[model samples]
Target: MDAIRIQTSAITRPSINLHTNPSGISFMKDKLLETDKSVFSVFGPNLGHYADDIIIVFKCEISPHPDANFSIQAATSFVSGNAFVLRPWLGKDPGSLDE
Candidate 1:
């Protein structure tokens, strides 16, 4: 939709990389900053795990998204709440249950 097109157009396309190291995430990110001649930072590691399930959050501005229903740029809590249903599950310890 228009939202994706606008966001993708404004967002920089990550450059081609040959390194297969898991840190290639960092390399692609570094290239983005390098191309812009600025320092890039990693806020923290492993939102869930080091798998591709990891997500990167860049605090950038977006024009009011028609689907976002927000007058301002989306915030983490706001976006997460709208996008996912968060719940906590209590699981028995495997060892205890086996005993």
Candidate 2:
């Protein structure tokens, strides 16, 4: 699982890259394909006129085989907030609530 924090005002398209450690094998954004094998759901706060920042969360499975790293890059659109990847959280189960 990975959490990507995107704080930008402009609407843009994002791309992800996956890499394998030890072997130093990596898959570029264009090389890796997004298949329907996995489905992801994103949850975030509604942007308002007064809102200055937003947090976008991405959830995905990580192979237990070890040596796996991913990166995300977005196209130009609206420039404002910075983007970064958050470390995976440990312990405590997420709550289940559907609004």
Candidate 3:
């Protein structure tokens, strides 16, 4: 079942890309598509694994705006992860992140 588990993990969890900036210093504020954890939670269950937790990369391939949130919506959607949870958060608060 290890293979199944690994495959599930690989399929469920979205792959994150980290790249360097022209300044040679990386910053996370980039590529944050979602700002809500609840979205990831729901995305987890459908992924065949309990939503133990979400990992927010402090730095992403793209740079974040000064007022951007940590969650990246594209990360979840593209990976078939969790972009739904972000819908509500986006409706109410555009840049809200828990912890």
Candidate 4:
């Protein structure tokens, strides 16, 4: 599971009345495509701002293929590409609330 926490304060410019820049807001769409071109080839209903934070959970069969795991790719890209602060956390399991 890959979890990313974006700091809203960092993305906003206080000088601009705390309103997010239109270009900066749109930057994620570009980055999403760049980061996961294979995953989001068409930019259909798969993408949206369903929540404040982005959490991608991948469930795949354990395979010998090295490329099967792209969690690192997603995490690294988000961290390296953005100037704003983003807290990304990677875990083997998305712990249950009951536990």
The best candidate by TM-score is 4
**Model 2: CA > 4 A from native:** 1-35, 46-99
Task: Please tell me which predicted candidate would have the highest lDDT against the true structure.
Answer: 3
Off by over 4 Å in 1: 13-99
Q: Please give the ranking of all candidate structures by TM-score, highest first, separated by commas.
A: 4, 3, 2, 1
- TM-score, cand. 1 vs. native: 0.15
Q: Candidate 2: worst 10 consecutive residues by lDDT?
A: 73-82
The residue-by-residue lDDT of candidate 4 on 58-96, one tens digit each, is 455633467753342433234344322332343323243
Give per-residue CA lDDT, model 2, range 12-71, as digits (tens). 322122222211122232122332222222244433342234454434555333554333
TM-score for candidate 2, please give it. 0.16
Count of clashing residue pairs in every prediction: 0, 0, 12, 0
Cα error, candidate 4, residue 64 (Å): 4.9
* Candidate 3, superposed: residue stretches over 4 Å from native: 1-6, 9-50, 60-67, 70-99
Ranking by lDDT: 3, 4, 1, 2
Please give each candidate's TM-score: 0.15, 0.16, 0.18, 0.23
How well is each residue in 5-85 modelled by candidate 3, as lDDT tens digits? 999888655432212222111224223532232223232234434233565544564345665434444443433324444
Q: Least accurate stretch of 10 residues (summed lDDT) in model 4?
A: 36-45
Q: What is the lDDT of residue 12 in candidate 3?
A: 55
Please list all clashing residue pairs in model 1, or write none if there are none: none
Please, what is the whole-model Cα lDDT of each candidate in the order they appear? 0.35, 0.27, 0.39, 0.37
